[model samples]
Target: MNHHHNPPIHHHTTTTQILKQSTTILINSNHLSTFFLLSFLIFSLRLNVETATHSLTSFIDHDPSIKSLLNRLHLPPSSSNHHSPRVKKPFLQLTRVGTLDDDDFFSGDENPDHRFFDTARNIKKNQTLLFFDCFDHLGFVNYSDNGVRVPELVPSNGKVEFKLSESVGIDEKIDADDIYSENVNEGVEDFLKRFELEHHEMSALLFLLGVLSASYGFAILGFVVTYAWVLGIVFVVVVNDLLKGYKSFVRTLWDGSNLGLKRLSGFIVMRWAIRDALTQLLGVWFFGEIEDQYLFFKIFVRLKLMPFSIVSPWVNGVEKEIYGFLLSWILLDTLVSFVFAVDAWIAMADTRKSVREVVKEGCHLLSLMLHPAINLKLLEGIVCGSFARWVLAGLFGKLFASAFQSFMEVYFMVTWLLYYFSVKSKDANASGVPFGQRELERLLEDVR
Candidate 1:
């Protein structure tokens, strides 16, 4: 009755559980610093563009002529206005991207009761009225809908006619032919010159200095981040070349050309570099263009390519445009990912395979991308992170937002690269052999 129970034995598995595999890869000390440096360079360059634009726009907003025009037009301030109170305002002037408010008002589609027309009629003869509704600027219109009211600002009395040039019609598209007269163009050019802000040579020189700093910073980052990969790729190509030459004399002669023997790795790196540069350029250009609400309301309109409208009770045209642009980018990203997978297969996996075979093999990876669990994880990390970053920028400042953006960029790049590697490994395992690495090992064995 005095027997003591033996202490329970615990089993320990050799394989450690990775809490979040992607996060583990991202935080690796070897990669973290390089990622942050790259992010800093990117953010700094974008900040330059935003700074230049903000400087120009701030000048326009504070101009007496522009202020007078806005006041006389009775247009409300932009909902997305970036102005700060006097005490909090920076002496050197810091600003956010876009910062301009859009103008919209009564629309033909929404005013079935002629309320807009009635309101316009009541206004005095000399005053100009801007009329609109949400649907007017939305680009999708039901021409036959009974709810549509033709926007006519002329009052009942002949003496109170409002000229077309004076009235701001939100829905009207300006025809080039109508405004092409030299006299009209000259007058418009003269008007714009008054609002244009000129930069001193000193400011231009300073901007050039900032760009050079970013370039140097990026180059330094490349040494740590890209140099290893470049060397590895070159080594792989050289090993492959040596193996082919040892295998057959006829093939060795032909394969020299096939191996892309002339600056092979350099060409590969250059191509990828160009692709990356274009992608960044396009993204920055789009961000700058889309944030301009003044340009959107005055010059641009929705493309009408969407099958159905994304109607929201509270969302304005600018918000809708942002959504549209985001959706477009998502689609473009997916297509680019697929193309990248194919390119990766050709470059790293097997150059001898037919295009169709490569594509067929790569299709297996699509399942991974479309997996519900993975999709949810991506949404949580990317979409939520983006929203949070934007909110933090609004609440705190750009520094916090820039940090978040850099982190997110690292996450995005690591996630996709890992996905590619995982898919490739799985494919090799299914085929009952290692592929790329195994070949390299065999080449080493032959050399030995």
Candidate 2:
């Protein structure tokens, strides 16, 4: 039981087993590496071929004139008289030389009457002739026993100078005339249609302007009526207050004393402060709020009649929010104006105070009314109120100067986006490709 047992005798050779395992591993690794290397080479070659093909196709497709030139140069015998026996000898000789005047150079002649080589030499020297020669090579233009005839090319040169019969030239001329006349007639018809469209557009614009003028007139009339009613109420209240004071003041002044001068000066100061307060408040309330609301309503109505498909729903929502905020501000301002008017009426009625005290009170009221909401403090009311008045006056002054800068930034951004979209839309339409939603979104994102 304690004795150790030997291993089995049916064992594999260690060297053979190691050699077979190593060979198999090496072969598999080599195959995988070779496969990967071949794959990489094929992928790179495919990419290069695709890039080259794309470039070639782009060039050929973009230039119609080049395509036409190639087509003209490669026409078949049935469609082309380019190998005419008459010019074959000269044509072959010239092409074989590889350079002009080779024969003349070999003959040692300086002046070789190159005018005889005018048609061929001109075709070689002039680029314009290349276009015509290409057409002729395709048999679009052909030479008879007399000369060449190409009705399409005639307009480019004004007239053809070929030694042909009168009847042949006349026939070619008639055909060219018919083509030119057709082109002219088409142009005239297009011009007439464009003119009519422009005239109709102008008429529509004029009618819109007339309607706008009428609307503005009505708005102005409404503003005038509102203003008159408010002023009338103020006038009645002020007149009643002045009548109550007239008896006392008139008698005191008739007493023939210079003491009335002090009272007069105080009255003048009080009146000036009241006038200034009214001007500032009404300007903000009427011009900034009421009139702005009227204009906003008018603009909204106009936009509702416009092509809504051209505008995004998000933009419409933003516009509605803007109008809502403006309307709320307008209502708040109207309430503030009414409160100011009531305060003015109350001050006018109070006749117990001395003129100096009235002047001080008027100045205080004006300062309190003009002060911004941010600075209004409940604690240290008198001291904080005075500071707030001056601070708000300075803030408003700065805001006035900065307003134009803010407006300009908004204007430029809107105009730039509009112009970019218009140009992109036109280019896409011209290229006969419709833009996808993602592409439009990307364009808007870039603009933003």
Candidate 3:
């Protein structure tokens, strides 16, 4: 047997190192003025949507007929002052149901800080509260629920007493919308008439649509400008400008006027548009199927207590299913992004390569991005960013979501660009040749 030693293929850079480097480079090259400009434009456009939505919501909330209709449909209450309650705060006192041992004592009962949270009126008396000790990673509460309470300033108390209304039975469940309901017997159409926009509201709606269109147009233009600026910074840093990367984006925007080939790296934008269109089509098809399946799954889960149900016992609600759908969507987006990242850079770097060739190489080299370590980290980052966007949108509405998305967009671009660079460097090193020489030889071979 021939004895031979094979060297281990070691990647010098870790995902963390790449992330840190990308962050530093992006911060150095980022233009806050452009970001703020885009944000302001988005904010201005979203203001229209917000106003329109708020106007519609307020109309529905304050209108007795509409409120009655909604109540008949068993929908949740609106977050408007039309149904705001003016109840006095309830008296709270702690009570210990069991005696404490000699070794067990309240450490600091005197002048102890106490806190109380008001729960919804629908809360039943015997409902279970699942508690976890996160600090120790304990799965569930360590103590029993029977004898847990305190008094005015007790520190080591575990139970509380609420001065609830005697009218509410222990097992009685309340509907939050009951107070907002009216005695009207109007039909849906009769109530919908209340939503007919006034002259001013109509004007606002029209203006909103106009502003929304303008915002989208500006967004497309902004995309081109951002690509130009990023390419400029990249070229300036890399000392390569063959694609006229140093050209002023303003002149290109002003002269070419439209999204034409005359603009700097306009073809890449065209590629992106096509890719995005296809991706969106894929999403529509995928999500349509997913929605149908999700509906079926949701119904199946809800019917778990019925005869011959197939769903697992733990699959009680649609929450976990929705998470699964979201995760699948993110994976799809990440994979699509992997291909587009390479394709975009190829289009920017070399116009000589046809679109077909660029796409072919992009798809071919996607395996590089799929390297276990790198892809997992990339997926984690995407998940974090997406989760943050969802949460911010829910809690604070459109403004914060728009701003966060804008920042993440550029940050991810820089990250993928750095990743491409790292992959190229690794390829060059593995081949034991300079990058330019390897490219030249490949081109010559292709020509042959």
Could you give me the TM-score of model 2 versus the true structure? Answer: 0.20
lDDT, candidate 2, 156-263, per-residue tens: 213234433444444343333443455445444432332233444435434544554554344333323322232222222222222222223332222212222222
* Candidates in order: C-alpha RMSD to true structure: 19.5, 42.2, 24.4
**How are the candidates ranked when ordered by TM-score, highest leading?**
3, 1, 2
TM-scores of the candidates in the order shown: 0.37, 0.20, 0.40
lDDT per residue, candidate 3, 176-195, as tens digits? 24421321112222222323
| Regions more than 4 Å wrong, model 3 | 1-12, 27-329, 363-373, 376-385, 394-397, 436-448
Under the 3 Å rule for N, CA and C atoms, how many clashes does model 2 have? 0
Write down the lDDT of every candidate, Cα atoms only. Answer: 0.38, 0.31, 0.40
Candidate 3, position 263, lDDT: 29
Ten-residue stretch with the least lDDT total in model 2: 305-314
The TM-score of predicted model 1 comes to 0.37
Off by over 4 Å in 2: 1-197, 241-324, 331-363, 366-448
lDDT of 2 at 64: 57
